[model samples]
Every structure is written in structure tokens, then in C-alpha cells.
Target: MAVVTRTEPPPRPPRRRRLLYRLRVLRHDPTAALGLILVVLLAYLVVAPLFAVLSDAFRLQYGDEVHAGQQPGEWTGYYLWRVFRSQISRLLFWEPLVNTLVVAVGTTLFALALGGGMAWLVTRTNVPGRRWLAGALVVPYMLPSWTFSLAWLTLFKNERAAGQAGFLQAQGIRTPDWLAYGPLPIVITLGLHYYPFVLLLVGNALRRIDVQLEDSARILGAPRRTVVRRIVIPLMLPALSSAVLLVVGRVLGTFGTPYVLGLPADYRVLSTGLFQSIRDRSTGVASVLATVIVIIGIVIVFTDMRLMREQRRFVTVGGKGAMDRVSDLRRWRWPACALGMAVFAVSVLVPVLTLLLSTVTRIPLNLSTFTLDFWIAEELPGAVGFPHGVLRGPELWEAAWNSLRIVGLASLICAVAGLLVGYVVVRGTAPRIAAFLRQVSFLPYLIPGIAFAAASLSLFAVARGPVPALYGTTFLLILVMAVTHLPYSSRSGIAAMMQLGREPEEAAQIAGASWWQRMRRIIFPIQKGALVTGIVLPFISGLKELSIVVMLTTTGTQLLTTLSIGLVDYGYTQLANGVVLMIALLSFTMTYLTQRLTRSSLASGLGG
Candidate 1:
């Protein structure tokens, strides 16, 4: 009847009908839009680079021109063949691959031994100094990998490659080649630095174990060791696997330790080899190496993920987990405490002390010879800006200020963007946007630090499109850092915002609170801790970072980490040590202050 009328209904309005359907779907499924958006963005960021890097790997190139023989932009397997299977692949890929596996396995074992024992001492035993041990155990994980690498070099560099006398030499000790450098030193250093990761994971798991399980096992006629083997070990497998994943990822992508300790001895792991290839402008080979690293990392991560995903329960019959009585070590308590302190002194304090001592000592990296003149004296004759005068020197201050400026700005950008990304992922009405935001947020996690830096360098090196000469800009550093740290920050923000819940915000909306007002009052205040962690974690991590910023800058924009690295290159071990110490101190200060504040806020938030 209506259609028969002169003003017939507008042609069924298909477009408007479809639009209305989508809106109805969105109303039915609000959070999914956000999830889809996050997933897409994350997929592009993580997977795009792999494709781009892979494409770069296959396409033949020499300077601006593609090679004459092959099709201009056609894909080829030349890179894979040349890097992985050629006669020279041994030097470029095979040996390095072997070295990486060896170091990784060795480090894994060492870390488990150290961390498991420490966990046992604190969790299951009346080990003296357990209170103090917990704090010290996490120190290594907190510091950057290279800090320990540099510390190892400062303490053990022999007269072979650099011929730089180290701390041992200063005390009239002739360290063997093995002690100074090689796979042994590399693995030990990496292990010591990473064991704390395992300690935390394993300790947390162990502490949460229900004592009643063991008691039940005992009641079932199971012996102590049997109870542990059948029950505890199985329970802890998930946490242990997670720890293994972390340490493996850490060692696999690391460039600094391998570079610092292995390179001088002609030892080439994947990172050092990849770095060398890039340095030689062998981008094809570097890409191949990076691809290899990525593949290995992905495999390990997926394995860990698969294991984690399949697990039904981390706890059995969850209760307020009982605290098991500590095993009395009898007379071994005091001695055990002493040993723990000694290890702490050497592992944590010694490296820091060495750096401070070296900074004061004029010889810098070559610590065998010492001079207070570097600290007290105004200037050295040939040194560019050195002697203790340089401590107060404008260049040093400028470098410090520049680092803070870039790092601060980068962290701020990351924090804000991360918060938005989190909110969108958690609260957006669009499914695609949600997935995209999540995927993009997780990209930096998959990329190796150096590779990511190189990626930035590659894309931005050429002045094209909207990017104008970002290759040397400090803004580039800020952008790169923010991007690199985005994955973690954004994740933290999302997790925080998720806990804010929909009810309160919904209530606010029904009460007619504006969007901004609801966000300012209800959402932000409730989830501030996670936001703080996002900011603080990135800021602290950026402070100790060298590998990312190293490939992206010149001496003019050198970071403290870069300076420590350069001091190594220049054979100024002591001054390098000082720079390292300063960086560590800065990190420690920030960590303590932020942790205190976080604790305070959480207490306040809960109390309120």
C-alpha cells in the first residue's frame, strides 16, 4: 500500500540497511571491534617486518641499482642459499649457529642450577639471609645484558686481542685465554645475568605451592623426593618453561655480550655475525641472519606458548597456599649466608665498584694501570675531553641531558600512546580496531633489538616520502625507543584498563558523566599502577639500552650505553666502567623511586 503511493519508499535502502545491521552487530558485540583492530595492527607491525625483511633478503641489490643478471625486482633464493648452504656459510652462518646453540644451552643449565638452588634455599630451607638473598637475586635480571658483559671484560680482558690488562692483571694475575674470553666466559656471564629471571619465576611458583599437596602425598605413602618429583616438579614445569623461554629469547637476540666477549677471539654467534655482516653492508646476509634468528625465536616462543596454553591449572585445589617450614641447614646456615653475600658482592657490587674505580682511574678500560688523575685532575694532554674535568665537562653534561631528553620524550610518547591503545583495545566498539591495536602493540617483542634498530636505519636512511632525514635526528632516537618499548607499555596499559571493568564506567555514563570526565575520574585513577609500570619499566630499560640506539646514532648523539661501548672500543676500560656504573645507578634510583610510588599508590588505591 505504501509502495503504491506516489512517495514510494526509497528503494529498500540497502546501504542504510547494511549500515544499520553493522551498528546492531556492534551493539551486540562491542569489545570485538577493539580486539579486531588490535589484532590487525599487531599483525602488520610484527608480520610486515618479517615480510619486508624477507623480501629485502631475496631481492638482489648493489647500491641503488638491482643486479643486472636477475629480473629487477623478482624474488630469488640466492640469499638463503648463499648464507645457509654455501662453502662460506660455515663462517657466516653455521659456526655462529653452533655457537649460539652452545651458549644458549649452557646458559640455560647454569641458570637453572643457580636459580633452582636459590629458590630452594629461600623457599624450602631455613637458609640464613633469606630475606637479603631475595633482593640480591633479582639484581642481575634488572641490569642490562651488556652491563655484565662489560663488567666481565673489565675484570678479565687478557693480553691477546686488545692486550688490555684487566682487574685480575692489576693484582698480578695472568689470566688464561679461556678465562678472558670465549664461549665459557660468554655463557657464564650470560648465565649469571639471566639466572635471576629463573629465580623470580621459579621462586614465585614454589612459594605458591600448597603445602597440603606434599602432606597429602606423604599421607599417601609417598616419600619426600617422590612427592617432589611427582607433584612439585610437574607443577613447576610451566613456570620453569616460561623462565627457559625468557632466558633463551634473551640470549638468542643479544648482540652486546657476544660482541664484547666473543668477537675479539674470533668467536661469532648469530648476533655478532649478523652485526658484522651489517657493518660490512652485506644487507642480504644480515637479513638472512635476522630471519634465522627470528625463526628460532618464534619457534621457541611458540613452543612455550603451546605448553602454556595446554596447561589446565597452575595450582591444584587452590587455597591460601601453605608456607612449608624451612629446612634447617644446621651449621651450614652462617656459611651459606656468607657464600650468598660473597656471590652478591662479586656479581652485583663488584661490577659497580669496578666501574666507579675505572672512571676515577685514567686508564679507563685498561684497568691494570690506575690513575686518580682522571677524577681529580683537570685534563689529560691527548684525551679529547677526558681526565676528571670531563666529568663536569659540557660534553658529558650535554650527552647526559640529550639522553634524558630523548629517553624521557620517548617514554612519555610510549606511555600516552600505550594508554590510548590499551583503552581502545579494552573498550572500543569496533572489532577490527581492537585486534589491530593488540597486534601492533606486540610487534617490538618479536624483533631483536639490533635488528629493529637496523630496520629503522634502513627505512629512514633514505629521505623519501614524509620522512625527511630522520637518520641522524635525535627525534629518530625518540621514535625508535618509543616503538621498541611500545609492546610492553601498551600491554601493561591494556591489562590495567581491563581491570577497570565496564560496570563503573557504564554507571558513570548512565549518570551522565562525560567521556573525558569518566576517563579522568573512574578509569584512570583505578588503573594508575599499570600505567605507571608501563612508563617506569620502559624508562628504566631505555636507560640501560645500548644495542638499539647504537646502530642509529653518531658520536654527537651517543648514549651512556654507547659511550661505555665506545670506551671499550678505545681501550678505556675504567672510564667505560664508570659510565656503566653511572647508568646502573640511574636505573637503580628510578626503579627504587617508582617501586616505592607504585607501592604507595596501590596501598592508597586499595585503602580508599
Candidate 2:
């Protein structure tokens, strides 16, 4: 037996040696190695910036040191005291927190009511033009979220805020404070922009529900209401909950709608408050507000996870023949169709028409005020940034090219990286590494875009170790855009990869193929559709993105979004509206062409 113990295999290798051995294992199976690399990279990109934000929250920031009676860079509790306990705490924190909750809750409720009804009508009822309605209703979401807010301001803006009176005021109608700006308009604007999320989610879930369950309940003499209350509602809870979480998350992080609508009424939400803090160079206060938003987002995500875990045992799908039975509305069919059309018109056509009308009219909503100066005039003497019409200026084309170059490249990187993350998560052998990569990549989605921008500014504003100062650089803009929009691409990748089998890669391996070779020759071809969807969605989103780019873009690196905001700042309303319309057209065209080329739909991407 040779002493029977064999000296325990030389006491095993040390921990370091074991790690090296694991690294060496990549020669045979590289998935774990790749997963670990992604985990580390994402941790640095996502978690490091957040750490910088948290550190700023506690440190004595510049300009704040004078107020706090502390030296800059010193540790202090002054920010906490000012934000939570001082006399202005209510104005700074409590009021904004309360308003944030009000807006978030209100928007969630309104969106649910509108979206749930539309989803039910489109997916469950025999509503005429269901096909068209389903496609048309999602167009609002495809546009920028703040488009509605801009349109609202165009129609109802009073002289309370700045610039000039809106169309209604110009027409001699007096718009009340509460109606013109505050929770009412903010809620409506957000609801219209975000309802498509609910519609898509609930509609998909509804389509998947086994109609046999309802049929059986009906055959058992259960009344329609009883069956709905007991079975249908319970089955739809998961989808509804998901939609609510999405709406709530969006509302929490939204800056443009609330800022545009809430400013005049002095209705400050958390995001706008954070924006003000940043703009005022109150880095400490901004950090604290950003931290609060991140915590709230974490709570929402955890709550959703808990609910999902509890509902894991409830299976809506079963081993039975299921069919989509369209409910016969007979006499109500035309009314239902009209209702669907009304939703589409309000959500899509109205805001767009409002903006279009504004761009052509010197005074919005005035037919006699129409002109083409904003679109094609060679020169405008008094214009600041745009001395010529928007289409005639080099600025518009430059910004558009920057947008296409920066966002296109970022989206491409995001798509490829997302697919790799999916591959590692689904096919990797190390469970912990896979889990870390998945979670860290999604961390950016939880943080508000403004907060992430703040973090990026803090982290990369100067050189840190190997990474040189990236502030005011195109690289920084691309990096932030890719990281912020990564969630969409990663989700699409994960869903697609989970459905893919390992057999193809295994066969390639049997033929002595390397990991890169297998991915290029086999996996890439299989997941190409998902790759395109991942890229296109982010491109559309980044094209209209304002919040993240607003903070990161400099004069030299201006994007379409920043240009539009600049025009608005300069009071060039018509030029601003023209740029926004261009963005909408670009986004819509890309979405349409991508769907046509790939034969995949936005619903599929979103539902996944």
C-alpha cells in the first residue's frame, strides 16, 4: 500500500498554485476563464464608479469645505447633516423624496390602467385592427421619453418658467399652475411614454396563458368574474408585477420629463434634484441623492426577486393543447377598435403632430405663423449656436455624424460584449463567476443615468492607474453609453443563448477547433439575429438619449441629444424641435429596417 496515505499528494498545491492550475485549464475549456475576465472587467466598470460616488458622498468636497469648516478631501458628516437634519433638509431631500414617490406611484398606476387595457384588447378580444394597434401603440416608447414633455410644454407652457408663453397662453387661455406644471403633467407625460412597456409585457404574457384553464373554469359553472378574479388575475400577476417594476424603475431615474414639467411649479423630484445638485457643483449633495436613488432601485429589484421566488411554484403553462380564443365583442367591436385607435392617437400622433406644428410655426398652433426658416434658411442673424437653419448648418450634420459614429460604435461593442456575457453565463462551468458577470453587468441599469454620469465624471475625470484621464474624450462618451445601455443587449443575449444548445460547439471542439474558432464559425452564426436585435435596440435608445450624454459630452464631442438640449437652452425652440424630429425619424427608420432585415420584432427583444 506504500505507506497507505501517499503523503496526501504532497499536501496539495498552495492556493495560488491551484488558481494557476485553474487558469491552465482554459487550454481545454476557456468558458470559465472568459467568464472570470468579464466578471472582473464589469466590476471595475460598474462597481468602481459607484464606489467613487459613495466616497464622494462622505468626503468634504470642494466649495463644501468652506461651508462645513473642514479642509477639502477631509472626511466629514456635513453633507449628511445638511441633507438629512438641517433647516433646508425638507427643501433639499424630504420634499424631493415625497414628490418622487408621488410621481412614481402616479405614473405607475396610470400606465398600468392604460397599458393593461390595451394589452387585453389587443391580445384577448376580437378588437378590429388588433394587428395595427399592437404595432402602433409601441411607437411612443420608440421615441424619446421627453418628447411628450416637450409637446406638453409647447401646448400649455405658461410664462411661469421662462422663455415665452405656450400656444394656449398665446391664444389668451389662462392655464392654472397645477394644470400647466407639476405632478399632473409630469404623471401624464411619463405615463404616455412608459405604458408601452406594460403593454408589451402583459400582452406577451397574455398570449402565453393557456386558455384551457379559463375554459375549464367556465365549464365548472364558474362565472366570468369569478374565474377572472381567481385564475386570470393570479396568472397575470407576474407579468403585471414585472411591468410595475419597470415603470417604477424608469420613473425613479427619469430626469427630463419631471425637470421640464416640474420646474415651474417648484415640484422637484429626486432626479431633478440630483441634476440641480450636480449643476451647482454640490458634488457631495449630488452623491448623496444618487446614493438614495440607487438604494431605492435596489429595494425595488429585491422585492421583485422575492415575489418571483414566491410565485415560482405557480405554472401557467401546462401539458395541454392551448389555443388563443378571441372574445367576440360583436356589438362592441367598433367601439373597442375606436378605443384602441384613441390610445394610439394620444400616445403617438398627438405629441408628434404638436412638435411638427411647432417647428413650422413662428408661434405654435397658429396657422398663419407657419414658416420654413427653422428648416432651410441659409442664415438667421440673431441665432446664437445655430446662425443658420438647423438643416443648413454644419452643427446639425456634425452632431448627427458624432451621434452615428459614437453611438453606432458603442452599440456594436455592447452587442458583441453582451453575446460574450451570455455565452459565459449559459455555457461556463464556474457557477460563481457566471453569477457575478450577470449581476455586475446589470448594475448600471439600476443607477440613474445622471448618477452614472456623475460617477463617470468623478472616476475618469483624471488619470487613475493604467487608465489615463478620459474626461472630454470620445472614448469616455462611448464607454458610458455602452455600459449604460448594456442591460438591453445582455438580456437579449442571455435569452437567446439559453435557447441555444452546446452540441454545435462540442462538435467543433471534437474536430480540434479552438474556442475563438468555434465561436466565430458556429455560435456567432447561430446567434446573429439576437446580436442584431441587441445592437439595434441600443442604437435606437442611444440616439435619443439625453441624460447620460448631457453630462459627459463636451463642446468638441457634441451629440444630437446634447445639440437639441443646447438649442432649447438657447431658446431656439424651432431648431430644437426640428432636431428632435430628426432623431425620431432616424430611430423609427432603424427599427423598421432592422426588423425587416432580421425578421425579428421589438416585442420579442423587449419580452426577452
Candidate 3:
């Protein structure tokens, strides 16, 4: 009887007891606790601001009180009406909407054609320079997208802009309006910058294709075109769509390129228009436009996700017999090599050389006018407040330091949080929680940078509960940078962690090592390369980030990207180009060093 009484399993432990048990277990288990905390934080940081943007779109804002005839903070459709139906709606919304679509479509097509071709050449064909060309083609992306715009302007700027004539125009070759500014240049520059994205995605997809499929078709007397059409094109469609969506999404949020190129022609896209609204203190208008961008971006992201799901259907599973066969180019080998090198020249060498040439000389490609003044002189003619050269002055150094410190800190945070998130995702017992954490962490990637920045500005511009108002502070920049760039590190972390077995961690745990001890001694030591890559990739991205931080940065908190933009605003072309060169060089050097250290390129982490 006593055994029967005790053997009832203590009345099956009350629900409260079971709940408390879980809580206690979670408290002891760092992964569960960390997962919970990250889910909450990422939801707040990544998802909350999107609601803030939508909220601001309908709710009356401070300056809109006069226009809406409603008190601030009150609900109204006036802002929506103004953006969609009012007199200036076309100018403020419709035209920019059209321009954004046009540019996005144009850029996507151009990027796909160029990137798809290059990917084929490098991965499938017997291209001579494939070894170096593969790495070199990714360089344009490391530099800022606007670097192309700067070069384009340096070479093609017309009298449409008030100040100095471009080199072509300076030599009495007046470039056409379309060549100098507006959608065409925006498309080309963005295409050049983003084609690497396509190359990475499609190229990886191409590499993964099983050559035996094609060989089998060929051995069966199928034509090469038939093999490509049936075997290759069908499999590549998903990657092609993904590349297109990525390019289009980037075009939607990109500010610097469109702003620099579009302004001269009075051409405006949604990003530049949103920026204008923010600058003009048209909060409601900005919120509306930002909401639209976010909506489009979310749609694109969902479509991409769907395509990715469908992509699994096409996965080429292979055994040890699988081999990637490179097609012999025969007499076309030299031509293919020449084409690859030519692309490298146009995309990497040309931009770098163009910026370098512009920095030292007022006139492009002119040796006589070359001077060290832009780099080291204490004073220069017509350069108003920025009297000293970029190299000689405290401004450039301070900005560089801030870029390193703020971006470095942000990236470090990203790396650590990403690693923790990966652990929680890969090793956690609670599937739902882990899945939620993964999705929430990645939500920021789908939100356009400009829209996210606007959302952040709207939500955190004022005090919200425990978090203080962070509008113009350096902390705000760090927070946004970390949150926006979290996807890269998180993906890298998850990929790295999936490959790491639990034996070491389990052994450490069995030896009575605490969770932190296990992570520090076991997990981190094994994932050092991934950790470094996580830090460096985000660092490079945030360093070159313009659209996101541009909205967040105030006069006191200028990053190199913003500082270069500021110089551009002041018409200090040489100094601005000098700063641009610095950014490109720094970005390239960091990427190169990270590749050397990790034995991996930026493309590895970016494959996600």
C-alpha cells in the first residue's frame, strides 16, 4: 500500500510544477534562455519598427498637424491621401514609384545578363582567367555602390549640375542628359555593383549542378542547346529569380547612387524621395513612402523565399562519382579570357583607377594636374571649410576612426549575437522557439535599409519605455548597424554551427563545464574562422553602408560613407573622391585580409 501510494508518480506533477520545471530548466540551460531573449529582442529591434512605420503612416505626426487639421498623435487618413491622392501626389509618390520600378527592372535585367554570363564563363567554360576572375568580379560589391556613380559623374557629368563639368564635358564632349543623370546611369551603376550578387548566387547554383546529367543527355545524342535548355535552364530558374529579386530589392532602398545621379536630372526614385521628405520634415509623407518600399520589399522577399523552397525540388544529389566538367573553349579560350579580364577591368580596376585619378587631379587622366594637395595639403583653393587635404586633416581620420569603432563594435555585437543565435537554433530542444528566432533575426534583411532606418527614426527618435531616445546618438548608429547587418552574421553562424557536431560541447558539459565555459572553450575555439568572418563581413557592409545610416547619422556622427557624401554636398569633388578611395581601399583591404585569414571569400558567407 505504501509503495502504491508512492508509485503514483506524485500525482503526475501538477501543471504548475511542470511549468516551473521548464522555467528552472531554461534558467540553467543558456541556449534556451538565450534563444528566448534573442527572439524578444529581435522582434523588438527588427519587427517593431516596421509597425512604427505603418503607425506613422496613418497617425498624425508633429508637423502634419497643420496640414491634416488634426492633433498630433491622432489617427487620420490625411497622410495617405496626401501621398496617394493629393495634388502633388504624382510628383511625391507616383512618379518616384514609376522611376523606382523602372530602375529596379532595368537593373535586374542588366545584372542578370552580365552576372549570369560571367557565372557561366567562370563555372562551366574553360575560361583561362577563371582563377583570378572568379575572385576579382566580387570586388565591385565590396566598394560602395555609389563608387560607380562617382566615377560616372567624374567622367560624364554635364552642365545640368551647377558646378564643375565632368572630364568628358571639360574636354568639350558634352555627354547626353541620359548618360549623365537619371534612370539610365542609375541602372548601369547599380547593375555593375549588384551583378556580383547574381554571379555569387547563380554561379554557386551552377557549380552545384551535376555534370553527369548533362553528359548523359549528350551521350544520348541530345544537342548541347537541348542539354542546356532541359537540364541547365530549368535548374537555374530559381537562382535567376532570386538574383533578380535581390537586385530589385537593392534598387528599391539604394539611396546614394540614385541621389547622386538622379538629382542632376531632377530624377527621383522612392529612396531619394523618401530622403527628401525626411530632410524636409515631411514625416507623414516619408512614412507613407517608406511603408510602400517596405511592402514591395517584403513581397519580393516572400517571393524569393517561395522560389528558394521550390529550389529544393531541383537539388542535384550526387555520390562520389559526381564531377564538375569544364567545357573546352578551343579557339574561344583566349577570347573568353579577354572577356573575363575586360569585365574585371571595367568593374574593379576602372572604378578604383577612376577614383584615384580624380582624387589627385581636378582633371581626369591628366598627369600634369596631379597633385598631392587632395591627400596632404593643409589648404586648397575653393574648398570652403574643409581647408586641408583628406590625408592631412583630422576630419577624415576622425571619421575613419568612428567608422572602425562604431562599425567594429556593431559587427562584434552581430558576430556574438549571431553565434548565440546559431547555437540556440541548431542545438535547442524547443523547435518552435528556435524557428521563431531564426525568422525574426532574418526579417531585417527583407526590410529595405532606407525604410528600416526611417522606421527606426520614427520609433526610437523619442523615448520608448526602458530604452532612451536614441535619435542622433552614436549608440543609435551602432544599434541600427548591428540590427540591419545581423542577417549576414546570423546566416554565417548558422551555417558554421550546423557543421559543428555536439561531441566537444557534450564532453565539456559532461566534465562539469558551465554553459559559458563550454561555449568559450569548446564552441568558439572551433569556430574561430567563422567568427572572424562574421565580424569582418558585417564590418565591411556597415562601413560602406550609406542608405541606412544616412538617415540615422547626425552632423556629429559622420561615418566615412556619410562624410564622403557630405563632401559631395559641399562640392568638394576631389576631397570627396579621396574619401571614397579611402572607403574602397579600406573595404578591399579588410575583405582581402579576412579571405586570407579564413581561407574563405565574402561570397561564402553571402551564399545565403
Best-fitting candidate, scored by lDDT: 3
- For all predicted structures, in order, the TM-scores are 0.87, 0.91, 0.92
Per-residue lDDT of candidate 1, residues 1-608 (tens digit): 45564666666668888999988766544456546554664454355556666777888757514432576456677778778888899999999989999999999999998877777676666777686687776777667677777777767777775634676776677788778888999998888888877777788777767778888889989998999898999989998998888888888888778888887789999888887887788877888888888778778777877878856676566566355445679999888788777767767887676666665654434556566654445765555534444365565577677778889888988887788788887778766677767776776787777777766665566665654767778988998898889988888888887777799888887786766687779777787777677788789889888778877778678787777677677665655666676677788888878868776321111100
Sorting all predicted structures by lDDT, with the top scorer first, yields 3, 2, 1
Model 3 lDDT at residue 367: 72
CA lDDT, every model vs. true structure? 0.75, 0.86, 0.87
Model 3 stretches astray by more than 4 angstroms: 1-28, 215-224, 316-323, 501-503, 602-608
lDDT, candidate 3, equals 0.87
Better of 1 and 3 by lDDT: 3
Q: How good is model 1 by TM-score?
A: 0.87
lDDT of 3 by residue, 223-261 (tens): 989998999999899999899888889889999999889
Candidate 1 global CA lDDT score: 0.75
Q: What is candidate 2's lDDT per residue for 442-475, written digit by digit as tens?
A: 8888777877888888788778899899989999
Ranking by TM-score: 3, 2, 1
